[model samples]
Target chain A: MTTTIEPRSGTAFKLGKGQFLEVVDPQGQQVSDLLAFNAHDTAEVISNGRTFDYADTIYLTTGHVLYSNRSNRLLEIVRDDVGTHDFLLTPCSQDTFRLLYDELEPHQGCFGNLAGVLAPFGITEDEIPCAFNCFMNVPVDGKTGKFSVEAPLSKAGDTIVFKAMMDVIIGLTACSAPKSNNGSFKPIDYIIHDHLDDVA
Target chain B: MTTTIEPRSGTAFKLGKGQFLEVVDPQGQQVSDLLAFNAHDTAEVISNGRTFDYADTIYLTTGHVLYSNRSNRLLEIVRDDVGTHDFLLTPCSQDTFRLLYDELEPHQGCFGNLAGVLAPFGITEDEIPCAFNCFMNVPVDGKTGKFSVEAPLSKAGDTIVFKAMMDVIIGLTACSAPKSNNGSFKPIDYIIHDHLDDVA
Candidate 1:
């Protein structure tokens, strides 16, 4: 098993040998990220090639490759127990924050979590656009043609692993979706491993 | 830009040719569930053929294709604006409902909106396994390896369209995920079209 801790701020590492990161929550739930980014300029780690349109994309556990826009392999889906994740959807915003909470103080209504994390890595807030909704469930309604949150597919310890195939800049944000049924401000645990190493 | 209203059920329909149904909320936000099903088995969709090792896989969006175990294209992602949906994740559940909210009656603790919609369609609740977290932001921490909710990537009026290359039975559930931050709910609206006169 390989365990690597990035304590230095603004430190970006290359996923050399395909590493698996397990994201766990406070309740031991494997909370995943809506979107993950690698700083590979050569397009080594961009997942979701032209298979699905960006605007309508949804993310799930298995059968996908994480590559750069240039189609460079960043991570390969190894274990997808959570089942699915959505890419087209955006995170709740200040407006949604207000809609979800009538008591939210003004100016405190912003989806800054991504920005907060990105800041340390020198990635601008504007650079952090709409990310993938990791573990949240949004099912579709055929009769009315709509979408609604359904029951969660993941358990407290269920996880998904990715084999990192390249050296890329990875950015992840702990979602603070105030509009979810699991809207509580809970935290998730993230672990990074070296290439060809057993994940934590 | 076609519109069809079913007066009897008070449901409306608007479909783009070769496009999947795009649902929206009153706020005009694209209601997240861009659906496609196998023309053969109403209960089966595609699997994540490339990412993980799972047989009966159903893709929400992005990485995986909804191909049948028989290697048939049950549902190919023609378009996805909801971004990458997570398949590893499942819908919210009763425990989560209770965990996210406080003071709500336990009677209200009942979850299973997906089943509510699918059950009527002959799809059992048990079939609703790990689904993708579409358009919902849940980020992972690279350092601490933690997970948290972020704002959604979608805005008001945004929607995704899909084309059913063949006749098929589709299931959807407009999520009524209550805001965990404020206990508020976001309702959704949608439209569907089967063919020229079969629009719903």
Candidate 2:
């Protein structure tokens, strides 16, 4: 199954174990925030700290598994055309705009978008953790420890695929922040394939 | 006023704006997880992402301000006897023990400890975000992006102090994990100074 998420908006859905999820940047310079939770337990949401601790690499790509707050495997990256992604940032929100872009009105950004869609799954605002940003660029300066959102390197049709390790609930957004999407908004594409063969 | 948090335990209390909070590692090699939320609004909690972005350093010390989710200043580090502390990892929990140490019984760790104390202020389990770990050592390999919780660098009587930027609710813990405390558990001390003159 394939679906399109409007720019600056998001949606939530479920995937059975062994299913494949492909998130695509149909247009260049777009960013998407992705979150996951164990279908059996909302408390077992995706954990950036645990995933980073276990993976040991901030730059995750194909074969990397997203770990849960409880340290269980939830999903594995089966393919990644654009490997650069951010695991450090909390999803942007009304506060983000008020802090950075004073000229524009504060939008809820990805955080609110996720909360809006994930509510039906019994997931609340607090259950949302830092997201796995696809096609977003945030480079950190080691000496200064400062990072800035940069334009994504993705081009039209670039995609990243994840294989579910367990039944899971997912919240995803076509990011709303101006800087995150190179100062413009664009829609995102996703597809669920029941088998690896279905992905290709 | 001064208080002591028992080994592997925690407590929470209100802090007035401009007051000083000094967290002491009474014994050497122990870690403390510290969290702050606006006293007026529990939803406006301390944020590591904003702090990291605005402060521009993961290795925070004297003179850095901790920011809130809404981009408000929450606390400022007034004194730091020990310089190195971790800003990346989440509070350790039951699953952390289950995944890392198979022989030891699973303990709720700092996450649970914080949740226990903060609940009274209307902050539920999900409201707890990543904490500001004092005297905890987690060094990330620049090339590999992997980080590990090493024993702290603090010595007996070592302390870190923060000046409240606002009236805030604070949660603190003397970490429970054995590895975090160099194979031992110990108490933590905190003093609330009504004024800078009270600190000395």
Candidate 3:
């Protein structure tokens, strides 16, 4: 199947003050561990008392809103059409690199991209708690009881935009888990746009 | 600079029966959000009487051997390389997959990998708590107080193999964070030796 995606962009704004964030995966493929956290405390940010579950969530092709735990508006996805996305799997870390790959490879240098983005805000790797894998697919089997990567449920070039709810620090990783079906070697691009004053 | 690596081939017994797991970033990198949980209980696991601290912890690396609250051996490094790893992460779950990735991805399907390994023996994910990233280099800068990923001090292909003291089941994920400087697109290979045959 062909993945159809549209380019979208947005900028950081006061999350609850009418800003939002959107992500569009055109191929409808799953992207695991796409998450946002409160940089100061490093706690998993929540909405409606629920942690962001990427697998169970469905980002509309357009016109969906992102909220925070406090019921504050973070961002609104102004555009979409990328197709279905996955959030079942998570981004790999150093420990994973060592456990799954040959022992000869130096895994100590491995780090989580989510932890990378929080560095500037006094959040270190230790402060990084459990995270959200935004786009990726993970299917569970009832009979054999196994998890496997499925095909892309999303298309290419789809977009979702989020307006910042607070002056929160956001960390994003263009995941590269080729070992699983959620991704390929192809690089994905993103666009971040500043919300207009009127929109705020 | 060249990465030094040690390979273990041919006879399995040739590999060291015991190895140390150390965590460090000699270049002075700060890592945060470090966590540890019981692989069996899914409850928060603590070290040195507390959840890991950035400044206080240098190496969650193997050789250090983890102690249970009851003074039992919970986990040991069976394979390793590089001087650093992630201690604060856990294997992704179906619930997490739905919230973090997308809802479409089957939650039950993705859990099989971890469950299949543990379930036959009656182990469950809730029993699989968060883990400490041993030998992972997560540091905090005393002067600037910044945290980031540093090249692991360990040689390439160097590993600390864990010997299962009991019939305990373990779940692992080889993280794929190219930016972390650990492994590549390929999956990490593991050798599940060191079975306490006497205990069984």
Best of the candidates, lDDT? 2
For model 2, how does the per-residue alpha-carbon lDDT over A26-135 read when each residue is reduced to its tens digit? 98789999999999888888877778756866667898999986678999999999888878787888777776677466898898999999999998775577788888
lDDT by residue (tens digit), candidate 1, B1-200:
43321111112122233545544433332123323344445445322321221222222453334533223444444445555344423344554444443436522111255555455456553344333334544443322222344455566555444455455554444444443112334544555645424432
* Cα displacement (Å) at residue A190, model 1: 1.5
Better of 1 and 2 by TM-score: 2
Docking class of 3: incorrect
lDDT of 2 by residue, B96-149 (tens): 777777646788999889989988889887667778999998765544555667
User: Which 10-residue span in candidate 3 chain A carries the lowest summed lDDT?
Assistant: A5-14
Candidate 3 lDDT: 0.37
What are the chain A TM-scores for all the models, listed individually?
Answer: 0.70, 0.97, 0.59
Top model number, DockQ:
2
Rank the candidate models, highest lDDT first. 2, 1, 3
The segments of candidate 3 whose C-alpha lies over 4 angstroms from its true place after superposition are A1-17, A24-33, A39-41, A44-49, A52-88, A101-111, A142-145, A181-183, A194-200, B1-200
True contacts kept of 1: 0.00
TM per candidate comes to 0.42, 0.88, 0.40
Off by over 4 Å in 2: A40-44, A119-127, B40-44, B70-72, B119-127
What does candidate 3's lDDT look like per residue over B1-200, in tens digits?
11211111101111222322122222222121122234454332333212121112324443544533223454454444454554433333454445444567533422334445455545444333344433334343322222344444444344444544333333432322222334332222344333433211
What's the DockQ of model 2?
0.39
Please state the CAPRI-style docking class of candidate 1.
incorrect
User: Candidate 2 clashing pairs?
Assistant: none
